[model samples]
Target: MKISTTSSVLALAAASTGSAQTTTYTNQSAPFTLQIANSANASLNGLYLFSCHAGAAIEGICVGGSTPISGASSTFYYNTTDTDVSGSDDGQGLLVWNLPVSGLPGTDHVSQSAALQPYRPGTNVVVPLFGFDAGTPVHFDDDKLTIKDYYNDANYVAGQFPDSTPAETVYNNWYSCWTGVGGGYTYEALSWVTAGVPHNPTCEKIDVIRTFL
Candidate 1:
């Protein structure tokens, strides 16, 4: 499994520059509850996840869960990414995207000084990766959080790798925060450990993406 630290592909997703984004509260799987909440001070726009079955198309299915975003907090179903993916058909992956909250009290766009932090509801714990400023040594919470779940759709089409590639699982938990200029963001690969159930064998690492958005 190959993971790239670039939002170049996700920049083409269906999202506006400064618009209100609608989100649905849904249960991810067992023991794991997906909470998408904007901070009180920060204006969060939207968080998007794209998945796919084959090719560079962002489409797939999330197996297991409950109704209306209320369920357990365990590792179960997995998210996916889009077309352009030319790897072994190892189920699906996720491309995570986050936009700033729209309509603030002042200013057109929130600067790093006034950036908001996204978090899981109730606990009031700030998520590690999604931030606008540099609180941690490494940061990706600057302007946007866009990710596409695929390795080499272009390379696959270019005959670089075989179609029947071996299927493997990969995890990515790094992000980039905004600087000042448009499309200008710094990269930061966060370091953390995984608890609860092991995110392998059964492909039960869906909590990584849904917890923020």
Candidate 2:
């Protein structure tokens, strides 16, 4: 959904006074793609983020080429409406997907809303869970375009955590991990892992970059 004009005016006013307000104005530099930076694999570098099903668990987020999933769109734009009732910017904004999800498959269940939530209860890994109509206002660092939760302030990572089968490994960090289910094989999940947690493979910190067209 688009940001309200009134909200834009407020943002401008707050910005003028150097007060924190939801800044919707990308200064005409929006309509950008999010890229995962500092990835261990060179191929994953500069690739855009997209939505995908995390093996029937939930409609989750993934990162890779333009079309990481069968009918998912990687392009996204900022929705700077003040979602926080506190009326503070604090780097709050919605990462709205460019495409509509009405016609996507039932299994896909993609929503424009880009939300970072737990894949399930009692798990360290935080998965990007979408489907909110108003869209959750994620803590979007305008300078970095990096998504962070307000609670821990941890940077989202693309994990290569091990799978249950031992021999098989999943690119995403979901607990019930398996491989070769999604359309793209190497499309990794966007997650947040607790610091100092041990894993066979470490999660790579991802940076979201803005791109034109």
Candidate 3:
């Protein structure tokens, strides 16, 4: 059952920089749904490291939620970096990505301040996201790649050993928003998170890498 794919991304309007790019979420699944609880969420592939064999020339990772444009999709870049991700965990300082979904039109919580204070914890909201390799294959500048899932799965109880804590008590499901670079989980590249509110039937399907170019 071989099928053809197209670039699901777009060369979003730019000022004609030294390069170009497109991004998308692939729809190879049975139209799934992910519920990123208040402090817990995740993606399908569980990919921590994102890479782009888009030549040596660096490019920027463009991540625009329901807004027109926010980050650079042509100059910023990161590829093959490592990310230790889980299915749960949402912490402060976590950069989440936002894409439009079909059943879930209209996105929310779009701000244009570099202060990084979109809103109070749990103030913002979004629908489920469909992962993809939109448009063409190229390098992105990734100034803010923290836009991945709800936060890394911090299911592990934080405490001292020996006089230890109970690990068999709670069936934990999530973690925090630790960077994939150092400290917590180590990812190989860049990534983003697509989450929706709690108990809400929010589902969406944006441009997936319909067919790989």
Candidate 4:
């Protein structure tokens, strides 16, 4: 690429106003692997990896701390273009994922809660794994499964809801059902209707997926 004085100045100015977004979970103290699943319920435009962008509607989160209960960092990127994302234009989008280099039989992961919050204004997005995708490659522990949803319908699920949640919460809640089936893990399928949320789920098992993980 050639650099010009006037072009350089404009480029720098534009670069100075973008955001990098990322979301990190409480890293397990022990070495653990996850075939994390994601649901867009929207588009991949504001998607972030390990940071946020200045104009990015959505930002990435960071994860740190020690096992069984780790912590994540806040969004951390600025002054960049959404199309500039690695995987977006080049074959480098999955920066957050290790890919081709991770644990085997990658444990399944679901996002009950978004890694972070203040999403691009919409309904709760989730990808219920009613059944594992058949005939597809087994996603690596670090492999990122894109959660692309563009038809923003709040009442998309069977229970008709606007009180959406994130994938992390979904995973955590399901994890709570580690012992058995039926009543033991019933809470994993619970959802609450806020006073003015405009939606109500009497059964609460709306986004909850019942299957052997």
Candidate 5:
């Protein structure tokens, strides 16, 4: 479902002078949690989006563990050139997330200067891609944030791809995945599966929840 940001929230979208007029929604002060939605599996419905570190790569994963680390939250911002007016979904814009660094001991190897972006490491191996300043433009439709593409807006999908070379699973059900340390199969990455693409049986369409706190 689409969560409408209030006029006050629109006030947060500041416009800057440039060749392309842009409106930016910065939600750092009002972080939100992205819970799995539209899933038939009851257990999977409560999973929340989180950041996971595998080797030197930081990726997005969904987990349902009971711990402070499981409380990971995120804030996002999007830039639209459609119009300078705030709160208007005039057109697709660059969507970026301020993903929290996983607090798992010894796995917090991400340097402070690294740039993170949404990426797929391999087939069905979607993770938080690093070393990029920007990602593809995305927009919200019917209250769900999605990737804005030429064909159509793509919904975010989460699932366990057991066929993947290493067989990934959601971490702790709490800790981040570390190669060769029994953490390998701990977490599965979130992927932006485009429309008309064949999805696995375990894949479920998800809705992002915008919560205050």
Candidate 6:
């Protein structure tokens, strides 16, 4: 599945399904591999993975800290956490968003469309995670995943800061370019929304196959 927005386009591809899928259970550790194609023509710096299950949206568990995404394609791994124990009990669906590389302050550079698939732990495969064909292009300057929403909706918290605080407001003001603190304010502003904004999740791809790394 893919979606196109006014300013940008997003993409996703199909994967395997049903009994061919294996569940990753609690207390088990495994590495899940993913690959992304940068059709947006922008360099990405991070990846935000989310899990949708039980009528609630939760942050998915990814082991390694994010790295830069560039070139025709990029590969990364979900190296952290016990997948089965962490995902929602009702269902295990995964969605992905790309964070573009930017130096602008108050610019929440997140993808607008999401790449989705069912969770199958212990599978190592190269999945064409996201791009312009599946979803809308991300607009960091406009579509924002607010810090308050992050705290209110998901289990992940922004740093050690309280879910909602005056500091967060200030940080968002500066991050969203509502203030004139300038580009140097990146670090301090980031302190406010530590988990960062997510994509709109307007698209999905099913039956994705797990590739062996």
Please list the C-alpha lDDT of all candidates, in the order they appear.
0.24, 0.44, 0.21, 0.22, 0.37, 0.23
- The digit string of per-residue lDDT tens for model 3 on 67-178 reads 2222222111122212312212221121112222222124221111111211225423221111221222111112211232223334545673332343322112122222
- Per-residue lDDT for 1-213 in model 1, tens only? 122222433232222221211121111112222222342312221222222121131112122223322211121232222331432223332222222223333322221111123332332212232222322221112212222232434335553556566443243332211111112222111112222332222221122234431
Ranking by lDDT: 2, 5, 1, 6, 4, 3
Q: Positional deviation of 144 in candidate 1, in angstroms?
A: 19
Cα lDDT of model 4 by residue, 98-198, tens digit: 11111213422211122222222343321121111111111112233222222344346785564455332112211111111121121221122222331
Model 2 vs. true fold: TM: 0.50
Clashes of each: 37, 0, 65, 42, 7, 26
For model 2, residues 95-168, the per-residue Cα lDDT tens digits are 65533323223322222455555344454555455433234445444435544432431333468443333331
Give the distance in Å from residue 138's predicted Cα in candidate 5 to where it truly belongs: 1.3
lDDT top scorer: 2
lDDT of 5 by residue, 7-42 (tens): 332222211111113223222123445555555555
| Pairs of colliding residues, candidate 5 | 2-143, 59-128, 169-187, 169-188, 170-186, 171-186, 171-187
lDDT of 3 at 57: 20
Which candidate, 2 or 6, has the higher TM-score?
Answer: 2
At residue 33, what lDDT does model 1 achieve?
23
Worst 10 residues of 4 by lDDT: 130-139
* Candidate 6 off by > 4 Å: 1-72, 75-85, 88-94, 106-207, 211-213
Off by over 4 Å in 2: 1-29, 54-58, 66-72, 82-90, 98-111, 119-122, 133-136, 147-187, 194-202
The reply for model 3, stretches above 4 Å from the true place, is 1-120, 123-151, 161-201, 204-207
- Please report how far candidate 4 places residue 164 from its true position, in Å: 27
Model 6 TM-score, all chains together: 0.20
